[model samples]
Target chain A: MKTLYIILAVFFLILSAIFSYLPLGTIALIPISFAFLFSYLVFKKSETPNNKFSKILLILTIVCLIFVLVKVFFIKNELEIDTKFEQQKIENNKDAKKDLEDLENDLE
Target chain B: MKKTLLILVLFFLVTSFKSDTENPVKSGESLVYSGSYNMSGLLTQIAQVNMTTEKVTTAKNNYLHFSCSLATYSKWDSFFKIRDVYESYVNPISLKPSLYKRNINEGGFIKKEKYVIKGSKVNSTVSFKNNQETQNSFTIGTNTVDVITFLYQMRTVNFANFKVGQTKSFTIVFDEKEMDISLKYMGKETINAGNLGKKECYKVSIAAKTAALKGKDKNIIWLTADEHKIPALIQFSIPVGVGNLTLKSATGI
Candidate 1:
């Protein structure tokens, strides 16, 4: 029983860590909560002194939770125009203008 | 007597298709929106969408250029970068599109498409990531238009005459194919219009007969009820979950 809980706690902790690193915002909280719950279960089931592994899992979950919380509250979504895209857009405009002029000549 | 009746019928047919109402969207107008994904009711903003219009003068003709672009936010750029632009050149008064272009680059997948519309026929060209290009021509309906022009033309529709639950259909050329699109009026709704604050808007639902768009009424949009008729909010449901685009700012209305 304790082994299963430990495995689950480790899996959820890794999942939450990945989610926290991404731009998923508060979604990491779901896996973080699960990690905490399973870690607690493992800690309770483990014999004394052997609870150190479970404690490590709890600490990792807390770290991911805090990181996600900070991002959700402090980070503002802003766009930085891609320079390559801008150049591509300019080139497209030139081509489109030439095409339009050709069409106008055809119509005339 | 028969000749007179035939002329009268032709006059009515021509007048019925002509709308004298002024266009609601004006050149120099721009609207910015924040695109967000909803997961279990939590909203995570992912991209910024900008819609702008400008007046362009060709060698012998003048037109209105309507452009919409979507760029992933700086933080999300590294994960799955996206920079897509859609443009339409249309008649200033009638809003009939003459040229349309789409440039899409998402996560390294690149595609370019253009359509030149002449009367009831469209000349289409497409280029993919592998540098393969194809050109084709298609006959379209008199009222058919490209997707970008269709979006702008949606504002010109006189919704006051529409009854609740009334549906208006349009044909839009997208991805080199003509598809049927429908908009159903769901009446008036007041929603949070982001930076514009609370606004009363016309609630409408969109339906398309395509695999990409699923569900009947899962995609809905709110356009401000004012003369500008700006698209204030949009809610769409995908296979995974729901997503939204909320208006962030408006200028040159």
Candidate 2:
């Protein structure tokens, strides 16, 4: 059981790191952090103290969560800017057609 | 077990929120335009006009062409003028290549004009010809003249590849006139166009830095969001009055 707990904690820590760049990283990291904490509790009966392993897992999970939060906020502005540019293009095309038609009629 | 169920619910909620905001319309799809209005000229001569526009992709060159027409009383004088204007532009595309082939029965106007812009250092010449004997010519510096057909050609090519959220910016040069313009999509909205019923349309607005014609105002075009981005309804407000053009009926695709 103790060995299994260690493996589960390691797996979750790696997953949290990988998804840290996505919007859902913080939420995903929550379960992984809980797993690492629960695993520590489960593996406390071991003869040797796992202080180094627990510290590394906690640090890695925290770093992953922060990375994901930053990414989500950074991309928000970029999405708005892209939509604005597209809107401008549609407006310009409509104006050009109207202008052309009006010019044709005026000359006639 | 309760915690696991809560997590699952939260995951679904987050994903559903994201999916709801995605645009439903695909890029480069054609939409229809329809609307109706009354047109009147100098003499209190009123005519009820209905107009419809359809965007068609030509199989020959993949160019996007707008096929549109307005129907009103046959007695209307403006109808002849409008027909003349339409023939001037539309006939050229078909007749330009076959200038040598003239049928005795095909009695139509053919006009051609050329203008040269000789500035301090820049020089360019533009030709405008129709099937009519009367031709108009204008020459100016390279900064003010606009080539009317070039704008139409740009629209043809750009709109062919245009995506829903893409903005196309280009400057059209005629002889000495230049019109710098931008087209922006304002998304889809349902408008209550009287008599034509409620329509789901892509509202597009246009702004031009320079307009050559006096009565031409900044344009707002509404295209039905179905299978044609042709202008279903168009509204332009000048200093004199407001002009609304709507698609009443259409025959050709």
Candidate 3:
């Protein structure tokens, strides 16, 4: 039973790694959380030879979760800040200014 | 036979003159405009605006319910597709909006705004798609109209009496902000349109004083030189291109 739990934990950690690379959004967090659950149970209250493996898996899953959270939440809306204040900065952009100039000329 | 022919000519002329007295804002009247945005001669059909005004009698007041829907064409749908519907109820006697509602979805962002006005104060609430909500208040005057109702109110003004370069100013409350909009009359001009070709129209440029609208937003509207005062053509200078919305058709007015 202990080996089974370790295998399951390793399987979920692998999925978390692949999904993180694929950028699956909040879905990637699910496997990572499950990996943590399985790793803790496999190593619970035991100092077996496999306990070291469980500890390593647990650390890996935690790191992957942090990465997924940062990618999904923080990196997704980088362009939003530009759009929110883009109206005031329209003149500073060369392409936008040129387009606007052409627009005014077209109106006349 | 000559007498009969003369009577027929008189009847035809009388009915032709009757079209000149068309009341644009009467119940069930509708106007549709289709246009495209041109960027450095590259044209793309980006917008279509439809407006319908109806006169209704409620238990308390006689109101004009105006509905305006604006949408982007399929070509521009890939970047940011907008489907917005704005409806406003105005007391025609006082020209003030009693209620206004907007359902807008641009790109993936969704927002719904509801404003209930009581005399000089307004209670407004906005519900967004991300489970976020906001409430606001505004002190408006009796002359303050919503954006949709403002179009109808502008038609009621007497433009012919104003001389060249004359300007008219009005305050309109839009999206939680009171905008001071000035329309400068640029004299009468003749322009060609897809449907109403070679028609003479009154030219007016928009100068709005509000943070909600940026200074880069420039617009010019041409109203028909008729008694009903229908908008003939509207051109806007946007960041991408100059959008031209020409009146295509009207009915029931």
Cα lDDT computed for each candidate against the true fold: 0.88, 0.41, 0.70
* Model 2, span B1-253: residue lDDT tens: 9999999999999866552112222223222222122223211112233222223222222112222222223232222211211111221232111001010111122322222222322222222243434333333333232333222333332232345655545454432355665555666778754444677876666556654322333466676555434456667655444456655443332
C-alpha positional error of residue B201 in candidate 3 after TM-score superposition, expressed in Å: 0.7
- Please state the error at residue A65 of candidate 1 in Å: 0.6
Q: Write the per-residue lDDT of candidate 1 for residues B1-253, one digit (tens) a residue.
A: 9999999999999877666244898899999999999988777889999999999887688899999999999999999999999999999999999899999999999999988888888888999998878999988899999988988888887776678999899998887678999999999999988677899999989998887766888899898888777899989988778899999999898
The DockQ scores of all candidates, in the order shown, are 0.60, 0.00, 0.01
* TM-score per candidate, chains pooled: 0.91, 0.33, 0.60
The better-scoring model by lDDT among 1 and 3 is: 1
Q: For residues B1-253, could you state the per-residue lDDT of candidate 3 as single tens digits?
A: 9999999999999966553123346668777777666555534455567787777554344667787777665434556776777877776665677778777878878888877777778878889998878888879877777888777777766676778888888888887888888888888898764455677888888878654333432588888777656787888776445778878776666
- Give the Cα error of residue B181 in candidate 2, in Å: 1.9
Model 1, residue pairs in steric clash: none
Q: For candidate 2, what is the interface RMSD?
A: 25.0
RMSD of 3: 19.3
Give me the candidate number with maximum lDDT: 1
Error of 1 at B36 (Å): 1.1
- C-alpha lDDT (0 to 100) for residue B206 of candidate 2: 59
